[model samples]
Target chain A: MLAHAIFFYIFSLIAIVSAIMVTVSKNTVHSVFFLILDFISISCLFIMIGAEFLGMIMLIIYVGAVAVLFLFVVMMLNVAQQKNQWFSARESSKHIPVGLIISTIIFFELIIVIGGWKYKPDLVSSMSLNIDSSISNTHAIGYVLYTDYIHIFQLSGMILLVAMIGAIVLTFRQRSGVKRQSYFSQISRERSDGVELIDVPSNKGVKSDD
Target chain B: MEYLSIIFSETYKILFLLVPVLVSVAMIVWLDRRIWAFVQKRQGPNVVGPFGLLQSLADALKYMFKEVIIPSSSNKVIFILAPIVTMTLALISWAVIPFSATQVLADINVGILYLFAVSSLGVYGIIMGGWASNSKYPFLGAIRSAAQMVSYEVSIGVIIINVLLCVGSLNLNDIVMAQESLWFVIPLFPMFVIFFISALAETNRPPFDLPEAEAELVAGYQTEYSGMMYAMFWLGEYANILLMCAMGSVLFLGGWLSPIDLFPFNVIPGAIWLILKILLLFILFALVKAIVPRYRYDQLMRLGWKIFLPLSLTWVVLTASFLFYFNLLPIN
Candidate 1:
């Protein structure tokens, strides 16, 4: 329990710090990186709570793909001018008042939430998995997904398919000058026929500009 | 007294395990330098200690004492947090790795899965570092690394499933024990090679180290890092290398098991054998890095996805069939 608490505190600290860094950093790339940090910390928190699958998915999908894509976009974007004056009077011109008001409201909200909170850690349900059972979490998850969550799973798949098709439609550009390979043609072509027999006549360059 | 004992036990374990890891990281730095020098036919860090063993320590101390130059133009918060994230994730992954029979921080049921999950988080640190640096080269490097990691990780995961099919357990101990009769290297030779290669790519070691290609990008995403932050990145890299090597040994070389296991030799400590096997694997890694030329970015991607992925997928099916034919599948 103590170990769990320690990990929770650490992850929360990291998440909060990274979140602030995302907005506070002068460099756009840095902000994107901070966003990656924030995502990772949250994922760690998920792992601490025994959502290992969710944590793994978060690491693989969000940190491995989305955050990276954002980093690339931010990196590629032009922000050469914002190099200096990062912490100067100019930053306050845009963010100071907004930051102050937001912080005040958040502080009040936190007070209200914390004041009314009743906290209790959930006990490990003995009935959840029998000790004599050899079936793993993956088996249980598979069973539940197939039976109870089948409809929702199908819906999600359909949504993904739609998105994939939409992406293909949007990016289907036909441009000239680029040579495209045909798998069918390549496979079907006979080596002899595919190889062109070229024999050019020699000494035909005497009649130049004249 | 009970609470004190618990605290003491935890502290003792942490100190004992962590000190070696720290030392190992230092030695890995020295090893990298020496290997680089040996390959190029020049001495590396011969000035400090015997064969430059103390050089890494000296360098680390220097980094520790040096000023952490926060780029005036950089994002202070993210820049600071990036290395910490990388190091923490790298260190945490080691918690589940069993060295021998007795040496392990956490003997979790899903040890292999946990390692995979935790190690996958490493790329985030690189991405964050690059993004936080607010530089073009680092950002480009980070993006490239992210893509490379994802592409290779698919094949790596697929290959792991092949091993799991044979071992019939996600537990590291079981995986190691399964190899007692014969190393997984014998039956799964192709998978072993693929796993090793993929691990190298995952760690961003040479040949696959497109992120830090000096000719193109000036130190890649780590361009802005200096002193201790830089050391932390290097240390984490080596630690990860060791971790992968340790895992590879356990998975393929039969962990700590000896070849001749008749009677008396069976009583010999498995931990020593495990370490020896891991060190051998690490040495192989070093040798390969020394010998191989860096692959082009396009070629790296092509090899990982078009070649390795399909190969691993095919092998998984083959392994499953073989297991079924032999009736060796774990009924559980």
Candidate 2:
């Protein structure tokens, strides 16, 4: 228990620091890298808490796919050269105080909620699906996911499918000048399509379509 | 005291496993070169040592002594961190990989998913390296890699679902154990092929190595990296290839199980069989690299999204239905 506590604190610290770095970094690429570090530490915290499945999933989804996408866009836009200015500009500085006030309020609200929330004594018993110690975390999730939460699972799949289609539809374009290989034309060409075996009267007199 | 003891023991086991892995990485590099040479009918690194067995070690030493050049425009911190992340992730994924029934580092419940997740995360190293270089070619390479890895990962995920459906468990040991009756390659042959191809693409191996297409990209993401930093990327790449081979063996090739349950074959330990299987798969990987032509970027994307994605998704549905209808789904 002590070891677990130590690991949790360590990971959470790393997570918090990296999270801050993600926003505060001057370079966009560096910010993305920090964001990845933030995700990794958070996932480490999750894994330390015995939610290994969720931790790995988080790593795979956020750090692997989403963060790479973020890096891609950042590099493509070449925003790393842009100097980060939070409140230096005269006009932009005016909104800094307001932003800080709102952020502080939100932060306090979150803290208050976390401090006030408590688990009921009977909460464990009242749960519909208790984690079975006999099975693995993945198995437990699958059991609940396919059974009681089947409809929600299917709905999420639908949502993903919709998102995929929407993305394709949004960025897809047909450019006029681009030449593409037509496999059908290439594959379906007959022997006589181009080969006209004519008896050349003489090398000089055999004129082609040139 | 108890926790300390556990940590110490775990560290020892990790060290034990890692030593062999590092040694094997060196050997595999040498072997890959020799095999490629054989395929091309040329002498490989025969002058270094007998059969050039010590070539990898010599190369490692050379890299260590060479100067690491950090480009003036590059993000120094990220440029360094990228290779470390790549190498670390490559080695860490081995934790959940069961060598045999009991020869694993961390035999967690969600072992397969853990492997999947770790393998998927490998793209970050390439993207970071590319972006950190702050060069045109490296950035282009990184973008290409990002899209390529992301596209193939979807299909790989779907293909794994097919195996999971049959096994009804994500545990690596259970998945391998379930293959006791018959290897998944027989039943899930198409999925196996798709998974292997996806694995190749995921690792940026031949026919799918558009990210580092030398003719255009000029060394791709590693354009700015030098010395040990460049070598680290190579190490990570080979480690990933080995991991993919191990995954292929574990998921479809019956892992540590011998080909036949004959007296002589069964005498060998399961770990040996697993190693043999991994070596076989590695050979296949090398052969594919030697033979297959590099894919066009558009064709690669088309294969992943248009072909593999639909194919693997359909296989998942078909596999589930078949398992359900036949009452063959393993009742976990």
Candidate 3:
């Protein structure tokens, strides 16, 4: 129990510190890195709660893809020297009140939530409600999602498909005065006359007067 | 009390081998350089030790003595933690690996899951390292690595499921022991080859190492890392290679089981045989790196999705049919 609590505290400290740093860091790149660290420590907290699949997904998607994309955009934006200072100062000031209010609400909510719930780790473990160790966590999640939550899963897939099609349609463009290769052209390429080896004199290739 | 002491004593005894094996994994850099040198008709690293066995040690000392540098624009917190995450996850995967019948650190039933989990976490370190570097090349490398890893990981998982079907257990020891009758390589040769190649691609070894292609990305994700931190990445990479090769041995080869059991002279211990097989695989990996040219990124992705994935999926079905026809599987 003590061991679990100690690790929980450590992970929470990492999560909070990095979360704070994400806002406090002057550089956009540094703020993104702090955000990545914050997500990772949150994943650690998920693992502590025995949600390994969710934790792995958090690490893989949030830190791996989304954060990398954020870094890419930040690096490629080509922030001008004078713009950087102005940008940093304006960005930090813009969100101060909003962030403070939201954080305060979340902090109080945590306290209220903990106070309202009766703590019973043993009962939760025995009931197999919070902890399900019969099989790999992925298996249980898959079963539930495919069976009980099938409609929701299918709806989400449909939503994603619509979004993907909409994105392609929005981006589609036709350029003038350019010939595009046909897919059939690639498949129907003939080798006999299309390619040939010819012997040529090396000196005739190029000659320099000097 | 006596039983607990016995377990502790056995664990300590195994540590003697595990510690050295882990350390020697760092020596792979020396081996990589020397092997490539020989391939190119040059003598390599004859200075540090007899035949330069201690070159890696000397390099480690050099990295240790050098000053650590942090860029003023870099993310201080993540920049410091990145290499530690990389090295720790790289080293921890060895715990569940079975070197021999009695030489495992943790022979848990979920050993395969533990391995996949650890290796999957490896991408986090790479992503964080590049993100924290606050440089162009590293950022691009990190994005490329993220996409590459996520894409290949799905195929690797499916391929591993094929192996699990054959062995019917996730424990590394059990998987190896099941091969005692005949090597899984004999029956699942295609899977063995595909898995080996995919392992190379997953580790981002040469040819598939687009993330760290020097001519392009300028050291890739580790562009900002220097001194001991850079050395840590080197050690972590070599350790990952060792782990992957060790995994290949246990999954396909007879692992610790000697190939020639009919003969009376079984001189080598199972762990030694395991080590020998992994060395051979490692050499093969290096050889491929030396000979093969790097594939274009699009070509690499096309091969993974269009070629390896379909072939592996076919193999799974083929194996399933064979097993079903032979009454080898529990249908219920």
lDDT of each: 0.81, 0.88, 0.79
- Number of the candidate with higher DockQ, 1 or 3: 1
Between candidates 1 and 3, which one is better according to lDDT? Answer: 1
Clashing pairs in 3: none
In candidate 2, the second chain superimposes onto the true chain B with a TM-score of 0.98
Off by over 4 Å in 1: A1-54, A70-134, A142-169, A172-174, A178-210, B1-5, B262-268
Task: Output per-candidate TM-scores for chain A, rounded to 2 decimals.
Answer: 0.63, 0.82, 0.67
TM-score of 3: 0.74
Model 3, span A39-78: residue lDDT tens? 9899889878877677867776676556756766765675
Off by over 4 Å in 2: A80-116, A119-125, A128-133, A199-210
Per-model tally of clashing residue pairs: 2, 0, 0
**Who is ahead in lDDT, 2 or 3?**
2
lDDT of 1 by residue, A1-210 (tens): 777788899999999999999878776766776787798899889878766666766776787667666766656666645545545546656776898999999999998776655342233343353432346555456567767779999999999999989999999998999986565688898989656555655965344333
Off by over 4 Å in 3: A12-191, A195-210, B1-18, B260-267, B313-327, B330-332
Instruction: Output the number of the DockQ-best candidate.
Output: 2
Measured on C-alpha atoms, candidate 2 has an lDDT of 0.88
Tell me the native contact fraction for each prediction. 0.52, 0.85, 0.19
lDDT of 3 by residue, B1-332 (tens): 77679769878866775688667775777888888788888898879989998988888999999989988998788888889988888888888878678878777665776677677667767777887787888878877776677667666767877887787666789788888888988888888888888888878898789988899999999998899999888788888888889888988887888888866526677888888899899999888888899978987887788888999888889888888899896222
* TM-score, one value per model: 0.76, 0.92, 0.74
TM-score of chain B of each: 0.95, 0.98, 0.93
